[model samples]
Target: MIELGVLFGLLAAAVLALIFVLLRRGNGSTENADGLLVEQARRLQAHNDRVSYNAASVRSSSPTTTDHYRP
Candidate 1:
């Protein structure tokens, strides 16, 4: 019974150690992180551009309060 408990503790410790080692190995370089930032900036700029275009289209096609209430 004592040996079984010791074995289970060692197994849990080894699994935790393996997880820590893998996470440490996955720490990437500055270049990869910078590339991610640049990609996000590009996506944001494209979204802004699309929103601007749609806003202009809606402004042109939709009527104003004055137009709606005009005699």
Candidate 2:
């Protein structure tokens, strides 16, 4: 039973080490990171603009408070 526990502990440690190395290797350069962030920001802005335009259109098409009160 003790040997089994030790084996599992070593396996877990090896997995953690692999994960750490892969993460470090995948980080890439700062310029690439900056570009990715900029692209993400642009996409976010476009999404926000589209949502705002759609919300405005919906608001314009809907009935007004005065119309509701009259009805």
Q: Which candidate wins on lDDT? A: 1
Model 2 stretches astray by more than 4 angstroms: 27-71
TM-score of each: 0.38, 0.38
lDDT of 1 by residue, 15-54 (tens): 9999999998897766558788998999999998887777
Task: List residue ranges in candidate 1 displaced over 4 A.
Answer: 27-71
**Clashes in predicted model 1:** 0
Clashing pairs in 2: none
